[model samples]
Target: MNRETLVLPVLAGLLTSALAGCGGSDDSGPGGGTIVVGTTDRIEATADAPAPLDPAQAYDTASWAVMHNAFQTLMRLPRAGSQPVPDAAESCGFQDNHSEQYRCTLRRGLTFADGRELTSRDVKFSLDRVRRIAHRGGPATLLSSIDKVETPNEREVVIHLSAPDATFPSKLTTPAAAILDSHDYDPKALRKGFEVAGSGPYTVRTEVDGDRLTKAVFTRNDAYRGELEPRSDTVEMRFFDDSAALERALADGEVDVANREFSAEQIDKLEAGRVAGVRVTESPGQAIRYLAFNTKAPAVREKAVRQAIARLVDRQALVRDVYKRTGDPLYSLVPTGIAAHTNSFHNTYGEPSVAGARDVLRDAGVRTPVKLTLTYTTDHYGPATAKEFTALRDQLNASGLFTARTQGVRWTRFRQDAADGEYAVYGMGWFLDFPDPDNYIAPFIGKDNFLNSPYRNRAIEDDLLPRTRQKAQRALAAPEFRRIQDLVAEDVPVLPLWQQKQYVVAREDITGTEYALDSSAMLQLWELGRGAEG
Candidate 1:
C-alpha cells in the first residue's frame, strides 16, 4: 500500500516499550547455510510499534519483506497470477453474489511455531485486533471494508463487509490480515520487536541496537502445517542505508542477494557485465511515482491549473534526464504490465506543447503565473528524487503559465506535512498492496486516500468502484477500470509520472533470484537457496 515495496522510505519515532527476548540463529537448516538478503529500507518502529516484525505494525517494505516468511494469511497471492489461493485456510470465497459476505475453512491440524493449535477463533481474533488498534501508518486501512468477523465453529470463519468488495480476498493476502496466535499478540496493542509466533514456514529472531534493527534471522517453523512448501530452512535479512551499501555487501559476499533502491548508473554497470560475480535480474515493475494535488489549495484549486501543468511537462525528457532512461513514463494511474492499464493521460494531454498549456489557462480566465510550491522528500526515493522535482520546477516555471518552486523534506516530516496539506503539490511513490488492478485504482481516488488528498468523484466513488469490486472475475472489471482511469485523467486529481523496472542483484552461487519478488511486490525469501548462479 506504501513505498515500502520498492522504496516505502523511512519512518521514525521513540520506542514506547523495550521488547524481544532473543531466539537462536540457525546456521544449518533446510537448504543448508544462512541466506542473507540486503536492502536500503530501514526498520521504522515507533511508539505504537513495539517490534518491526509484528504484522500489525510491519507496513513498510523492509518489515513486509521478512513478515511474508514469519506470518501466514488465510489467503495468499499465488506465484504467477493476481488471484489469491488458500494458504492457512483450506478454501475461501464469497458466499453471496453481492460480494459482501465471505467464508473460509481452516486447514485441519494447523499449529503455531510454539505448538499452539490455530483455529477460526484465532483468525477472528487476529482480524478484530487490527480494527481495535488502528495505527495510522499500519495496513489496517486495507481491511476497513470489513464490518464483522464470525467464527461459527473451530474451522469455519465468516466475514461480513460493510459494502461489496470482490477484491477482499487480495486484501487478505496482505500483512494486514496475517493470522497470528490469539495468545501471543495483544488484542488491542502491537507485539513489538522480533519475537514471532505463527503457523507459517518460518519462525523469526532479531538483532537490534536501540530503534535500529540491524538484522532479522529466521529458521524453519517445525510446528507449521500449510500449503507453502518453503525451499530454504533458514534465511537472514540485513538492513542497509542505501543501494550502494547493499551492493558492496553483495560484492564482498557478505549478503547472498540485494533488493530495491539501485541507482540507474549502478544498474547500467550490471547490465554491461561490469559487476564481477553478481548479475542483475530485471522485471517489468509494478511501482509508480506521481504528483498529488491538494484539491482545495489556492494555487491549484481550479481544474485548468492542474491540466495546464500536465500539458507543459514532458514525461520522456524527465525519464531520460532524471531516471537515466531506467524508467518508463507512465500515462495512466494503472501501470504497464498490469491488466486494464490504459494511456488515459497520454490521450488527454497529448504531446508537451507550450501553446496548448497557455490556451488552457487563458480560456479558464486564470491569472498569469499561477503560484505553486512542489513538495518532495529527498531521502526516500534515491538521490534522483530531488532532481526529479527540480526537473518539474524547471518545466512548469519555463512554461510561463505557472510560478513553481520545489521544496525538499526528509521522509518523516515530508509524510506528516503532506498529510496535513501543508504543501499545495505532493510527490509520492506507490507499491501495489495486491497484484490486482484495483490496488492501483482504489487507494488513490477515494475520499480518504493514502495521499491525504480530498478527491471523491460522485460517479467513481458511488458507482464505478462498487461495480468493479462486485465482479468475482477480476478480468471482467477492465471496462470499469478504463472508465475510472479516463475520469482520473480528465479530473487531474493526481498526475501520472513514471514507472520503474524491478531489479534484483545476486551472487553467482545464489538460486531463484527471479522468484524472490512475488506478484504482489512482496519478497519470498523462502524461494532463495544455495545452487547454481541465477
Candidate 2:
C-alpha cells in the first residue's frame, strides 16, 4: 500500500547489486525439457508494417521480453537490481566525472545465431538504426541523450552524449539498444517479416497469425558467447487475448508459467493458495498507468479541457472498486517512492469536485457539454479496463460540463490508432524503460512521444532535464524535478492513474523463479528450468 515497498533505494541499490553476485545462479548445465509460458501481452503487427521482431521497432513489454532474451546488449540489469552491468561488453563505464561519455569493450569470439561474428560495428549500427528509422511509436525516444556513436576498433565502442546523463547506461539495456547483426538488418527502415537473428543466450523462431505474434519458440543458442549461461534448452512463449484464457492455460497444464496480465480476482486467489501447485514471485512494482492526450486532437487540445477532466476523476473509487485495490492511486507521473515525486495533481485538485471542473470550463469561455471521446484497449492491461472506462465516463458526465463516450479496441489496432492521433483522449500504461524519474516524465511529454502526441515543453525538454542529468547524485535534481512535475500539472498532457505490483506465477517444480526478473521488468528466461523435485 506504500511506495517504499514498491521501489528500491536508489544509490544503495546500485552499490549492492554491483558488488553482490549472490542473487543469480550459475546453472550452465544442459536441459532436455521444454518450458511453456503464457501471457495476455501480444506483439502487434500490421499489413503495412510487418516488422515484429526487429528491435528498433519494439517498444512494448511483450516485444521487450522476447527481444531481450534473444538479443544481447552492451549493458544489462543485474538479477536483483536496476543498475547496469556488462553483458556483451567485457568492461563498460563512463569516462568522465560528469557522466558525459561512455565506452564499452566487446567480449572476444562472440557470434550470432547463424555463426556470424559480433563486433563493435554491430553495436554502433544497432543504435544508429534506432535513430535513422525512427518509427512512430518506437523506442527511439530513449536515445535522446546520445549525440553520436563511435567505434575506435573492431572491439571497442565509444559514445558521446549531447548532455551529461548518469541514467544513459540504464537506457542501453532496453530493447532499443539491442546489439544487432549489421549485415542482417536494414539501415533505413524496419526490417520486414517475423524472422530475426541475434547473439544472446537464446535464438527465437517466431509464429505469426495475421498481425499477431501468436507464439515464439526460443532455443538455447549453442553459438552464443555472453555473460549468461543458459539453464534451459528451449522456451515456448504463448500469447492470449485476455487473463481468463491465461488462467485456464496455467490450470490445464498448457503453460508451465503464467507471466502477466492476471485479473485482480485471479491474483487474489493465487495469493490465498486457492490455485494449487503454483509458486508466486513478486517484484517491487514500478510500473504506472495513466491517460495520455493527443494534443493535436480537437477539444482535447485545449488545456482547460484536459485540466477539467483531471479535476473530475476519482482515483480512489477507481482503485478500490474497479481494480479491487490491487494498485495504489497515483497522482504524479513520477510514481510515489521514485525520487523527485510529488502529488502535484492531488494538490491542485483536492477531492473530485464538479464545481471545480465547471468553473475552469466557464472561465476559459469553453461551451458547456464539451464532447469527448475516451479510448482504451480491450486486451492490453487487464479485464478491469471496461469498468475503469465506464467509471471515468460516469464521473465526467456527473460534472455536467462534458459529454464523454468510450470506445474499446484490441491492442493491435488501438496502438496504431493512438499513434495516428485518431483518438481525442486514450488510456495507456508505461512499464519502466529504466528505474529513473526521468523515464517517467521525459517519455510522455516530448514532441515525438511514442504515442505520437504533439505535447512539447521546451523548459522540460531543454532546461530541466539537462540540469538534472548534470548531477551525479540523483536526489540533488529534486528542485528541477519538482519544477518539471509542476509544469506537467499545469499543462495537463497526461493524467496519472495508479501504480501496481508485478507478479510471475510458475509451477512448484520450477527452479529459479525468485531470480527470474530484473529491476527493469524484463523476464530473464535463461534463469528458468525444471527443478529436481519435478
Candidate 3:
C-alpha cells in the first residue's frame, strides 16, 4: 500500500476534529479550574542550572515531567503499556528486513501550538539537532545509532541507522525525540529561556520562575493531535524545596496531586490516614538508585578496592533503614521484573562482611584505613539521601577497611560536576525512558553512557549489544542480557543499591491515580482529574 493511503485512515482514527467541542466538562474549560500538582524537583534556567523545557537539551526526570506533556513525539507510550503507538505519526516501522532503515509517515495537518506546520522535515531537524549540539550529560546519547535522517516528503521520514537496531523506534518515544518546528527552534544550539513551541497535549501559558520555579501554568493545546485527551483543561505545576513542604501543600488542599521525592515517613503517614482526605497509590517502579565509581580516580582504580567496597554495602539494611523498605534491594543494573534480571551482586559479594572486605584489601596489598570521599546532592534526591549516604559511610568505617568522608552539593552543581568527574564516588538514579532491558543496559554501558564516569566494556558494548539488538523478540535475547549483568557485577563500575516503589498522593476527590503513571514511571498530568468536589 502507498504511504498516503495507509496513513490517512489511521490519522482519521487517531485525532479528534479540531473544531469539535472540547471533550471534558464545560467547567474544565481552558485555564478554568486548575489541577495543582506538587513535586520536590526544581525547574530553573541559568548558567549553572538550566531549565528542562527545551527537548533537545533536557534529559533528567524533573524536566521530563513537563516536557512529556508539552511536547509530542512521533510515537507515545499508551496510558498503560510499555509499548509505544503512533502519536504524531500515522504509521511507523522498519523499511527493510534487516531493520537498518526505519521510517514513519506523519499524520495530515499537524501543527505546532503557534499554528506553524509540523512536517517530516521538522522531525528530521529535531533528531539531527540533538546529534549536532550533543550537550554533555544530555539525551543525545540516546540517538547514537542513527547515521542520518532522510525526509522523503512533507509526511514521510526515513532514519538510516549505522547498524541494525530494533530499539531505535523505542528511542523515538523518548522526550529526546520530541518533534519541534524548524521555524521556532534554532538548528544549531539549544533555545534559551522557558518559551517552547510544541505540538503536545498542552502548551505553556505562563511560568513563575526563579532559581526554583514557584508555579508553571499549562493550558490545553487545541492543536494537539494525539490519543491522550486531557481530563482537566489546565494544569498548575508547583515546585517544593523538600517533601515536608509538599506534604504540607497536600494537607492544606493547595495541591491536587503530589509526586517525586517523598520520604518513607511521609508515605507511612499518608497510608496510615494521617492525611484525612488524601489517598496514596503505589506501584513497582523501574527506577534504580546506585553508587557510581570513577575508575580513573587513584583511590578506586584497583579492581580489588572497588569490589571490597561493594562487599561492604548492606542492601537490606540500607533499604530498611533509609528507604523504610519502600523499595527493594537491587543487585544488578537491570531492576527486577525486567527481562534477564539476575542478582549478580549478591552472587558475587554474598553478604556484607567486614572480614571479607579486609581480606580483599589486605590481599591486594592496599593499606588499611583508605581515605575515600563520597558525594551526593542534598536538594535533588530528597531528604532520605543524607541518611542513606551516612549509613553507607558508617558501613565502610565500621568495616575497618576504609575511612570515608561524605560531601553534599546542590543538584544543579552536582549534575555538572558529576559529569565532569569531580567526585571519586557519588550516588545516582535512573528512571527509564522506555521499559526495555536494552533501555536499562545500553545507556549505562555505551561508549558515551549516562554515567559520565569513564567505563568501557567492549564485550557488552560492541559485541553483546549489537547481537541482542538483532533479535526481533526481546525475550529471546535474555542470555545476552544475563551475560551483560554478570560483566557489570564483575567490573563494579556502578553498584546497584535499590529499586524504588513508585508512589503518588492525591486528594480523595482526585481520580485516575492508576492511570497517572506511565510505563516509564513518569506521572501523566493529563490523566489526573478532580471530581465534583474539585
Candidate 4:
C-alpha cells in the first residue's frame, strides 16, 4: 500500500509483539472458527458494470480493494505511519538525464501463481494497457505524462515520460496501474471482463452471497513473491449489505473485521468494548469530502458566487453533527497527512459567518434569495451522508445567503448523473488516486476534472501542476500545490469541506488489517490469521 492510502493509526506503535511466536489469534471476533469480513454492497456507488479485472480497466474503489490483494505493485507505501517503500521492486530510482527515464529493478525469481516469471514486460504491458483501455474514465489521464515504456532486460523496466514527473512512481502504486500477466489477459477483451488474473498473494476463486459476500475467498498462492507476509490459508471476504447488519455481525462474531462505514457514534460504541474481544483502531486517513459546484450552472459560474457559497459552509458543525468529531476540518482539495498538502484555502475561508458570505456576495453585486440544489449519494460513504447534506442545507438557508434544495441518489445512478453534471452543486468525496499532489490537482482542475466542473484555471493547469509534477520531492512540490490552493480558494469551483478520520473495528484475532488514507482500505489477508492459540 502507498502512504496516501494509509489510514488514521500512526506509526507510533510498531512495538514488535513477538506475538507471532506465540501463535495467531484464534477468535474471529465474537464468532468462532470462520473469519468473515464486512463490506457495503446495497449501493453500487462504484463499479456498476462488469469490469475487466485488469489494472488498466479497474476504475472503481471497490474493484481496487479486490485488485490490491490479488496484484502487487513495483513499490508499495508504508502502512499509515511509514514512508513510501519498495514492495515488488528490489530498488527503484531515476536512471537518466533530467529524470525523464525512471527504472525499477525487479526482485529476483518473482513469479505469479500461474508460474509465469514476472518481468519488465508485465510492467510495460500494464502501463501500455492503461493508456489503451481508458475505460469508464480510468485514472489514465495521469498517464498523459508517459511517452513510452521499454524493457531492455527481463528485470529492468524503463519508463520514458513526455515530461519530468516526480509522481510517476506513485501512479504505479495505484490499482489502476497494477501489473498483470500479459498471457492471462488480452488488452482488447478487457472491456468485456476477462478472468481476474493477478500477481498478489491471493487469487479470486469465486463470488458467493450471504449476509456478507460469503463465498468470496482469497486463497494463498505458494508461488507468490511480494513483501507482504499473509497468515490465513484462505480468506473469506463476506460483504455485508448494510453497515448496521455488518455491525451486528461484528458484535455477534460473524465477521473478523469491519471499517469505513462506521459512524462516530458507532465507533464510540465499538471502542467502549460493547462487543467483547472486538478491538477498534481509529486512524488518520487521506480521505477528503467536499462539495463540487458545477461550473456550467449559472448561479455558480461567477467567482464571487462560488466564493460566497463556500464561505457559508459550516465545516466544523458538519464534522460535529455528521461525523461525530471523527473527521478533521479540511480546507484544501488534498487532505492532511498526505505529502504536499496545503491549508491555504482553509486559512482563507476561516470560520463560517453569514455576514462574511453576505458581504462577498454584496461586493460582487450578486443578489441573495438564490435557491440551489445540493446532491448527495444515498448508499455510498455510509448513511450519514444524506443527513450531512440536509444539515448543510439547513445551515446555509439559516444564514439567509441562499435557499438550499437537496437531492439524494443511490451510488450507481448517482455517480453517472453527477459525472453528467446533473446537479447545481454536489457532495463528492475523494480517496487519493495516488499519494501525490498530481492526483489531487489533475482530478479537480482544468476542463477534465471528474465532476465535469469545467474549471479552467489556466495558471494552475499550465504552470502550477506541470511544475509540481516535474519536481522530484514533496518539498519541491509544495509551492506549486500552494499556488493551486490559491486558485481553488479564488475560484471556488469546488469547496473543500472536511477531511475524514477512519475508525475500524476488528476482532482481536485478526492481525495486520488496516485502513490507508488513499481510499483503498486494503487489508493483507495473508497477514490476518485467527486468534493466538488457533
Model 2, 1-534: lDDT tens digits are 000000110111100111101111333345436777787766666764468667766676667777888999999999876678998999998999989899999999988989999999999999999988876666777887789999999999999998899888888887788988999887988887677689989999988887778988888899988768766877778888778887888777777778667777887888788777776655446677788898778878789999999999999999898888778898898888688899989888888988999898889989989998899888667788899999999999988888999999976677777778898898887777777788787676667655567899999988998888888778899999989998999998899988776667777666766566677656778877776623
* Winner of 3 and 4 under TM-score: 3
Candidate 4 runs further than 4 Å off: 1-34, 41-48, 79-84, 191-195, 208-215, 513-521, 532-534
lDDT of each: 0.76, 0.77, 0.76, 0.66
TM-score of each: 0.92, 0.91, 0.93, 0.88
Under the 3 Å rule for N, CA and C atoms, how many clashes does model 4 have? 31
Model 3: lDDT of residue 179: 88
lDDT of 3: 0.76
lDDT of 2 at 13: 10
- What does candidate 4's lDDT look like per residue over 365-421, in tens digits? 988877888888887667788889999889889988788888888666766676677
What's the CA error at residue 306 for candidate 2, in Å?
Answer: 1.7
lDDT of 1 by residue, 1-534 (tens): 573322341111100011011112344654546777776666755554456666666666667766778888999877666778998999998999899999999999999888889999999999999877876556666888999999999999999999999889988987778898898788988786666677788888888777778888878888878867666777777778777887677666677666667778878877787767766666667678889899889889899998998898789998999888878899998989888999999999999989999999999999999888999887677768888999999999888877888889977577767777898897888777777778777777776566667877988888998899888888899999999999999989999899877666676666655555557767776666665433
Query: Candidates 2 and 3: which is better by TM-score?
Result: 3
lDDT of 1: 0.76
1-534: candidate 3 lDDT, tens digit per residue: 000000000011101111011112336653235678777776666684364567767777767766778888988878776777898999999988777999899999899998888999999999999899887667887888899999989999999999988878878887889888888788987886677779998997545545446666678899887678787787777778778887887788777677767889988998899987766777676677788898989888888899999899999999999889888999998889787798989998998888888898889999888899999878766689999999999999998889999999976687778778888998877777777788778777866877666888999988998888887687888999989999999989999999877776766666555666566655467776666414
